[model samples]
Structure formats: C-alpha cells, structure tokens
Target: MLQATLRFAQTAYASTKRLFSNLFFEDALGVETNRPVALKDLGLAHSDRVDYDPSPWLALRRILPRNEVGPDDVFADFGCGKGRVLVQAAGYPFRRLIGIELSPELHAVAGANLDRSLPPARRADVELVNKDVLDYAIPDDITVAYFYNPFAGAIFANVIDRLAASVRSRPRALRIIYVNPVEEAAVLAAGAKLTREVRGLRPGKNWSLRKSIRMYTLAPPPC
Candidate 1:
C-alpha cells in the first residue's frame, strides 16, 4: 500500500509539472502546442505512426545548448507535430529549420504556430513539408535531426538508413536528437554513436521512458 501511494504521488507530480510547463511555454511563445492529438483523429490510426505529443519545452535546450548550434547547422524535426520543437529551435541561430509531417492537418498547424512563435529576426529559414518521412529525402546540408519516436520498426530503420546515406555522401558532422528513443538500436546499427542520455524531468528513482531524450552523432564514413 505504501509503494502504491508513492507511485501515485510521483505520477501526480509529473502531470502537474507538465501542465504548468506547457501552459507557461505556450503562452510565453504565443503558440498553441500543448494539445494532444490522436493518430485516429488524424486518419492515421491504422498506420504505424504514433499520436502527436509535444516534447517538454526545455528538452531541446537541455540537450543542445544555444552556443553549440553553429551558423551552418540546419535542423530538421522529423514528424514535427504542431511545430513545438521547431518553435523552440527558432530561438537558436540555426541556418534553417525544417519540419516534416505526414498529417496535413498537423503540418498546417505547425506552419501557423511557427509564423506566430518565431521572431522576425530569427535567422533560420523555416520550412514545413506535408508528406511522409520515408518519402522525404534527408537533405545533405542538414546537420541536426530530431525525432520524438515518430515511428518504429521498418519505417524507423528506413529513415535512419536515409540519414546515414546522407552522411555517407556529404561527409559532414551530424547530430540526431531522439526523444523517447524506442528504436535507438536502429540508429546505432546505422553507425551513429550515442553521445548523451537525458532522463525524464520528473524527480524520482524511476523515470518514464516517454520523457527521456537521447543524443547521437553520426560520423562520416572512413576515407
């Protein structure tokens, strides 16, 4: 009984933290990204895609510091739902920001959110593509890629293969920020090295997998 009570308390605290964080960030940024969307609602219930749940506001900053983002770095958010990460990334000095989403509804919402949230002086060139991630080719100039466990199984493997292929061709430094890395093995198999692991924000001995973030770097192939 004592253990159960402790678990409940932990869960409640995490939920409260998420709620306030979302409220604060969304309001401060002038964007609406806290709402959750089901795959079924977006007509992707039968597909391999997962529902849309924005990552914590501070997740990106916690992993990649502002100074670490170079002027040449082009960031892409695979399956960027409602552009929460994209908006957060806009504060950085990335050369460009790209968001690829399979759902047209979410893509539209992401575009709108970016327009409202991104500052006029933001240097990144923002692009929101409404298409399947598998169909979208990973640009060679992209140095950073972010994923929120967008998809799993064969699809995730295929995407990683494309990312690796891009690195093989361009031979540039690549960093992949994967939140809730359910398919981390696929990334490692594609020759990416895990550089960092960030647990959930909730304070406890037990951390939720859904709130974790992993950072990986893919090196260019041997000369």
Candidate 2:
C-alpha cells in the first residue's frame, strides 16, 4: 500500500512538473519524447539500458557549482534526450555545449528545442549530434561531461575508456557529473575517484526516489 501510494504521488508530481517545465523552459517535456520508449526499444545490443528523464533544473544548478564548472569548460551531455539539460546548461557560459543522442526522434526534438527556445547567440554554442554515444568522438577540448545514468556495464565502461584515452592524448582537466549513479562501480574501475555526492533541492521529499548523485574524476596517476 505504501509503495503504491508513493508511485501515484510520483506520477502526479511528474505530470505537474512537466507542465511547468514546458511553459517556463519553452520546450516540449516528458519521459517520452514523441512516444513512450523503453530501454529495449533503443536496440543498442551491448549496452545495458535506461529510460530518459529530465534532470531537474534546480538539481543541475546545485551540481555545477560543486564541480566548479566555468565559462572555459566545454560541456557534453551523453544521451541528451529532448535536450532539456542542454537547454538549461546554455544558461551557463560554457565555451561550447555538445549533446549526443541515439534516437533520431529525440535528436530532432532536441535540435528544434534549441532552435526555437534559445536566443541566436546562445544557440550558436550548441552542437546536437544524432549518433550512437560510442561513435560520437569526444573532442580534446571538452573539459566537462554530464551523464544522467546514460548507460551501464559495457556501454558505461566503453565511454570511460574513450574519455580516458582522450585525456591521455591531450592531457587536460576533465570532470564527469553523473546523476542516479547505478553503475558507480564501473566508473570507479575506470580510474575515476568520487569527489562529491549530493541530492536535489528538498532532499528528504524525494517523490522520484532517485539515489544520491555522485561526481567522479580521473585519479591522478600513481606517483
């Protein structure tokens, strides 16, 4: 009974928040981009799957300050669905913003959201790519990457390997902000050390039931 009631409350809260987000953010909002999509529907054979959910704007604001993200950072959002995070991220003065999404429908919506909602000057900073996350090359210049439980296991491992390789090829500061970190073990295995963990605003009142988010960075090479 308790679990069922919690679920109902969560659904109601999500609906109300979605309406508010669409109005204030000036973008289409929901777990379903065009239609409901499940993890299996994505069809990325090797990658363990997760569904899309927009990061709360307040939560994002809290995490960015903890990471010390600044104008010089080039930010990338993996599995950026409907570009809500990307759009919100534009509020910051990052050098550039990149979003990678595999679903064509979500990518199109993301592009449209950026085009329609963002001012021309801010829109210029965005690059929305429709490609498998694995195939999307991480440019050496990117210093910050954001993932909201984009994937786990193999897919997660592969992404970290690529990020590590990028750092090796062109050494620079990089930080990864991961929310709802279900595969934290994989992240730690790939050489990142946890720097911080935090919850969204109104912490004790978690209608969504998400776990505490964690920040990770590559451990300095052994002395």
Candidate 3:
C-alpha cells in the first residue's frame, strides 16, 4: 500500500511539472500551443488519423540539435497542427520551413501563430499548406521531416514512399523525426535507417513508450 501511494504521488508531481513547463515556454514565446484538440471535433473522424497534440518542447530540442542543422537544410512537418514544430524549427538555421496540415481550421491557427511569433526576417521562409499528406508531393529540398503519428496503415506507407522518392530524385540526406512512431515499420520498409530513439521519462525516471521519438535517416540513392 505504501509503495502504491508513493508511485501515485510521483506521477502527480511529474504531471504538474510538465504542465508548468509547457505553460512557461508558451508564455515566453508568446504562442498558444498547449491545447489538445480531437480529430472528431475538427470534423476529421477517420480511423487512421489521430487527434492534434503539440509535440513536447523538450523532445524537439533533443531530436534536432543546433549543430546538426545547416543553412541549406529545409524542414517540413507532415501533421504540423498549430505550427508548434514549425515555430521551433524557425529557431534553427534551416533554409525554409514547411507545415502540412490537413484540417483547414488547424492550418489557419498555425498560420496565425507563425505570423505572430516568427520574426519578420524569418516569416518569409515559412510556408503552411492545408492538404492531405498523400496528395501533397514532398519537396525535394526537404532535408528534415517531422511526424507525430498523423496517420497509419496505407496512408502512412504512401507518405513514406513519397519521401523515399524525393530522396531518390534529389539524392540528398533526409532525416525523419517520428514522434510516437506507431507505424515505424513503414519507415524501415522504405529503407530508412534508425539513427536514434529518444524516450520520455516520468517521475522517478521511468521510461514512457507513448512519449518516445524515433529518428531515422534515409540515405540518398547511390551513383
């Protein structure tokens, strides 16, 4: 009984700490991205699609180190709801940032957030597109892609295939940052090599799989 009570207390403390940390970042950046919205609420009641949840700030910082990013690299977020990742990517020296959101409502919110948060100089390089991922062609210049379990099954496979094709055509290094990688097999099937995995830890340092993020690199086609 004592052990169970201690565990519960630890979990509660961790949750509260996370909430305050997220609020602090949002306030510091002057952006509102902590809200979670359901797909059905946005009229996207699809079995394969998940709801809109902003990626944790810590996860992004851990996955995309500043030293790894270059001026020539272009970053794209596949299900960039509310532009949280795009806003974070703007802090890097990437040549451009693209956000692809399927829901028009969320897309509009993301655009507004970017307009308000990003500096004038960096605003021009950010682009937000409201279209299905499968229909939209992955830009050849996109060197980094971010996904947060946007969709599964055939949709996920098709998107990975498109990423692979883009690499084949342009022959450039492509890095995929997949958060909550439920359909990771599809990425491996497209010949991507797992570079690293970042796991989230709760209070007491217990790992949580649900908050894990996986990084994969797709090599350019050989000459």
Stretches of candidate 3 off by over 4 Å are 1-14, 203-207
Question: Which candidate ranks first by TM-score, i.e. highest?
Answer: 1
**How close to the true structure is residue 57 of candidate 2, measured as C-alpha lDDT?**
59
Estimate candidate 2's RMSD in Å. 3.6
Worst 10 residues of 3 by lDDT: 201-210
lDDT of 1 at 197: 84
Cα lDDT tens digits for candidate 1, 96-186: 9899998989998897888887666662389888988888877899999999988888888998999899989889889999998989899
Residue 220 in candidate 2, Cα distance off native in Å = 4.1
Query: Global lDDT of each model?
Result: 0.86, 0.75, 0.87
Pairs of colliding residues, candidate 2: none
Task: Summarize candidate 3's per-residue lDDT along 16-59 as a digit string, tens digits.
Answer: 86688667777777777878889898788788887898888777
**Local distance difference test, candidate 2:** 0.75
TM-score attained by model 3: 0.91
Better-scoring candidate (TM-score), 2 or 3: 3
TM-scores, one per candidate: 0.92, 0.82, 0.91
The CA lDDT at 126 in model 3 is 97
Candidate 1 collision pairs: none
